[model samples]
Target chain A: MPLNITLTDYGVGNLYSIRRSLENCGAEVTVVRDMKEVLDAECVVFPGVGAFDKTMEKLQPYREDIREKLLSGTPALGICIGMQIMYNSSAEGTTPGLGVFDGDVVPLVGKVIPHMGWNQVVSDDPLMDGVGDRNFYFAHSFRGNPSEDITIGTTEYEGTEIPTFFRKANTYGTQFHPEKSSTSGMAVLRNFISFAESVL
Target chain B: MLTKRIIPCLDVKDGKVVKGINFKGLRDVGYPPELAAAYEKQGADEITFLDITASLETRQTMLDIVSETAGKLFVPLTVGGGIRSVSDMRDALNAGADKVSVNSAAVKDPSIISECAESFGRQCVVVAIDGKRVDDHWEVFTHGGTKPTGIDAVEWAKKAEDLGAGEILLTSMDADGVKTGYDIPLTAAVADEVSIPVIASGGCGSKEHIYDVFAQTNASAALAASIFHYNECTVGEVKEYLRDRGIVVR
Candidate 1:
């Protein structure tokens, strides 16, 4: 049986890659434009695209409901800005985040503003099972800074360790776009599918 | 550590990938999605579609190609050429482009850079500078690299960054397609002048040329067309060559 995934489309950036990638991974993906649909999802995917505040444009109203659902272990996946919104707030935007995690999303301290391009990830989690030592593509200036306990993966850049992956309960958020990270990234998505299948 | 990138550029015209000699005498190669997918499998860090279509009538064809290709790419897809305004950028991004590159439109009015950056986060805005060495410094060229804007390439790069450009696609007209190597001094000057990452373009005939650009300059990535188009070398082969020479590539 295919795992039913509800992908949120808050009308920010393109969701083609994420939608296509999830479908290719053998999941029945449904992109819901209305933010409220996220609450009732069997499995939810919050894609990382667009500005932080603007990304919260639609979800701001239902922030509490969505947070409650996710915290109750609703099988949620957030990427980049999607992950940022799960925090209390972000330096990128003035709007308040969903507070799924107990920390704030902050700007990365580095010479290069946006840590663009591929970088190595260090994690022994199940998602990294077949990912091995392959690097993942990243393109963002800000990242979530929740406590180290929730951070399952970290990627070093210019001597600073940037948290790239977070997992708490049944929810997971990634700073890097697994959909755009090519084959190794696909491996992570595949693992997530298997995870959702097992959990379901 | 962030690994250096190798991007394969697909110059498309009228819906097909085309190869040419110094941006002229174009020849059709293949479909954009088909070619881009192959490059992705070959370990290309990213794929770029440089739409060289000449008329307004054919621009939609390129956008259609972008939509088709972007739907399949697992890697970041950047589209360039013929993009003029924020509306044009909207069309491309809405059609599924991750980032859009503006050239002549930006050189004519720098405000477009900030506007586009404002409209769609700066990370999605890329300013492409076609440069040619004259006397001691390089001058910016527009209109398909046929007309020189008399703007200093180094200064323009800095201004673009200041205006909120996320990255600079520096193409050296003097060394373009010559295959000797990237114009190291020119690339180094601009890269050093700007803090934002720069992608070195043109004059990449061999893997050694790829090595020279990365080893000598601070460019975050290097783009090539002919070398990978003619099967002279694959993105995988170049990466292997770079990896063997103690340079990190993805």
Candidate 2:
């Protein structure tokens, strides 16, 4: 059965291509721009771009709805900023996150603000099935410093290790965009969908 | 032990690969997917897709191509050109791109760099700057190098890093297609000013040039179009030569 994947669209996101990529992987993807569209979903994905503070403001009204969906045990994936919002607080903003993980979104210290290009990915999860230790593409200034148990994978920038992929319970998050990450990136997405299906 | 990177930049229009000389004399290269696959086979460390069309209609076509190529190629791919919003960056990334490169958009609204980096993470965002020599000073250009933005290259590079840009694809309009070599001096300047990885573009005529960019300049990677596309040399041969010169490569 095709897993029903709902990508939340809160006026700012990269959901359409994410939807297409999920569909390409044979998952039934629905781009849910409205809060209620998230009701019936096997997997829910939050795709975001821009500031943490701004995203929080846009999603505040739907906090209750998001919390309900998450508590229901539906698989959820957060990309980039969406992933950061799963934490407690971020250096980029004063707004609190979803509190799914006990951590904070901190900036990449020592190095420049935005850590760009193909940095390495140290895979340690079933979701990272075919990815190797080679450099995976990256672009972020801030990163989530989750607890050791939730840190699934990591990448280094200027000698400091940062979490590149995070997972906890049915909730998963990728600091890197699986959609734009090439073949290994696609493998991650496929694995996530597979996981979502098996658990469902 | 950082592996040296070799990136092949593809200029696209109407969803087809196109090649040009110094931003002129353009000719269709091939299909975007086919060319990406070839570059992947050639052992390109990464591939970049630049949308040459400056129209909304053409941008949609580029998205379709990105979806097609991302479905097939597994290597790291960077997509740029006409990307204005965070949503646009998300579109490229969701289409299976590893990074979204912004040129004019970032210059017009510098905050987009941080906005994108904050949302997508810095690793997935690249800022491409088209540069040209003016009165012995490097100046940033826009509109496919048709207009000058009057922004100093060195200053802008630092500002971009501050704005949360992960990497800077520095292309020299004057040196592009000329095959003289990468602008080592300019690359060195930018590399010295910023700590992030710098991908030097616009020149690269021979294997020695690759070595020169890394040795003479602090550039983390070197990118070229005509040299790799026209079969002047392969990435392996260049890496082998660079390795012999004591440069690390994967």
Candidate 3:
């Protein structure tokens, strides 16, 4: 049986692309906005693309519910700003994040405003299986500075080493868009699905 | 150190890949989704699909094509041609396009740029300027390079950036199909004028031309069509050539 993945749709981010990518991975994907649907899913994907404050506002009501699910070891993945929001806070806005992870999402020190395009990722985690040293697509101005213990993958831009992927127990997050990272990106998603399957 | 990008543009007309010489003489090539997937496999940084048909019915067809193609490929997909409003941009984004490039419509009402940018983040709005050399300066052209707007290309680029356009797609009509090279001076002027990323389009015959533009101008990315479509060189080959020439590419 396929994994029952519930992707949170708060009327932000590229829902179509993420939904399509998950479906392509053979998971039974359902986009949900209700709190109950989010808590009941076998796997939860919180994908985001927009201002931090607005996203936090949209997700405010579901915060405790999502936190409870994640604390119980539900497989959860956050992509891009979704990953950023998993942290305690972000410099992008004054709003506090879900605070599942003990860190901050801050602006990248790179010269470019939006580090948009593909870059190499170096990792040893099972999530990086078959990913190797291949480049994955990234398009964000902020970088997650999660504690080193949770960091599973890292990418260098300019002189700063930003955390690209992180995994702590069953909670996982990536700063890059695996859905937009081409073949290797698909591999990362597949690994996440496998993780979800293992829990099943 | 961000790497420069090499983008392959696939023009679709009535759901089939089409190539036009100097923005005219349209001819079918193949299925767009298959062509796009091949480019993705060949290591293209990004793929752009321009629906040349630009009609109501054709727009729906393009949306279906985008949904199918975007599902298969993981790279960024930018769709252009006949995107007139924020709702149109929303439709494209909902269909799975990462960015929406506005050309003729933006020229007519510059506010559309800010509106789209405000609706969707500026990162999703790309202002495509089709330019033709007029006297000493390049003038912006509309209606797929058929109508001269008399707007200075460089000035328009700056304005577009000010109006919240995250990127500019500058295509030189004069040297479009000639393929001698990119319009270096034009690209340089616009790139210098705007702080946002500028993608130099048209007249990319060889890898050296791509090198010339990147070396001589501040353009962040270079776009090509015929060369890739006709199998002159693969995207990997171009990136390899660029890397060998002391340019950084992913």
Candidate 4:
């Protein structure tokens, strides 16, 4: 049987790429609109790129529930703004995040603002295992600023290294858009599903 | 270090990819999905779909094409041409575009850039500026490079950055179909003025042209059409040339 992945849809941006990418990786994807249903999933995925406040609008109220589920060893993957909301606050918007991790989302330090394009990742974590190029597609101006040593991956931009992937138990967060990141990105989704299956 | 990007642009007219010479004399090539997939396989860092016939009537067709192509494309997909307002940007984004490139409309109302940045994130907003060299300075052009705006190319790039455009797609009108190489001086001026990543468009015939832009200026990506669409060389082959010449590519 295929592993069922519950994708949260708060109606901010297109959920097609991530949903379709997950399906391509051999998972039975179900995009759940309700916060209550999101908690009762085989695996959870917070995957998209949108404004922080707009994305956290419908998801803000259930912060405690989402955090609790993630903390209780739920295998989850967060990408871009999806990963940003795992922090305490974001400089991008006024809305408060779920605060799953002790951090804030701040602007990426560089001469260039968004740092849009492909960049090599520095990580030896199992999550990055088997990625052919080790280079992931990144298109964001801000990244998660974790307070502790939960950093699993880092990418360099103009002599500055930003913590891109943060890990806490079975939950993982990455600032890159894996779905739009070509084949190496597919390796990430494939690895995530396998990791989700093991934990579930 | 962040690797320089190599992008292949596909001009779509009513859902099918087309080829044209300097924005004139068009010809049908292939569907968006297959060509995009082929380029992606060839290690294209990103793919752009320019709606040459981006009229109000064919707007829905472009959106549908974006939806169809994005479903099968793995790398970042940028859709340009015909994005006049936030609603248009929203439609393209909702239809699965990773980024929306705004041209002529942005010149009329600069606030459109900020609005789109506010509605979506700045990362999804790309400002495409078409410029041509005239006398001693480059001039910004709109309406498919037919109508000339008195805006200075360098100043407009800086203004677009100030107005919250994430990236700039700087295309040189003088070099569109010439394909000798990218307009190095024109590209260098805007890219040096903007703090955001700039993708140099137009005037690329060989892999050497891509290398020239990256080595000659701060342009982050190089966008081409006829060179790659005609199968002169694959994007993978271009990367090999860049890598061998000491430029890092993913």
lDDT of 4 at A115: 76
For residues B1-250, what per-residue lDDT tens digits would candidate 2 score against the true structure? Answer: 3466888888887887678422212243478787777777666778899888848988778888887886667566789988989988887876767678999889999999998987866666788998898997999998788889999998998899888787889998888878899988889889899988899998778878888898888788898787777777777788788878898665
Residue B96, model 1: lDDT of 86
Worst 10 residues of 4 chain A by lDDT: A33-42
TM-score of the second chain in candidate 3: 0.95
| TM-score of every model versus the real structure | 0.96, 0.79, 0.91, 0.97
Distance from true location, Cα of B14 in model 4, Å: 1.7
**Candidate 3 or 4, higher DockQ?**
4
Docking class of 3: medium
Interface RMS for model 1: 1.0
Model 2 residue B158 lDDT score: 87
Instruction: Write out the backbone clash pairs for model 4.
Output: none
TM-score of 1: 0.96
DockQ of 2: 0.21
List candidate 2 stretches off by more than 4 Å.
A68-72, B1-5, B13-16, B20-29, B40-46, B50-128, B133-136, B139-151, B159-167, B195-197, B233-250
Task: Give the per-residue lDDT of model 3 (tens digit) for B9-64.
Answer: 99899988887423212242487777787888888989999998989988899999
Q: Which candidate would rank higher by TM-score, 3 or 4? A: 4
Comparing 2 and 4 on DockQ, the stronger one: 4
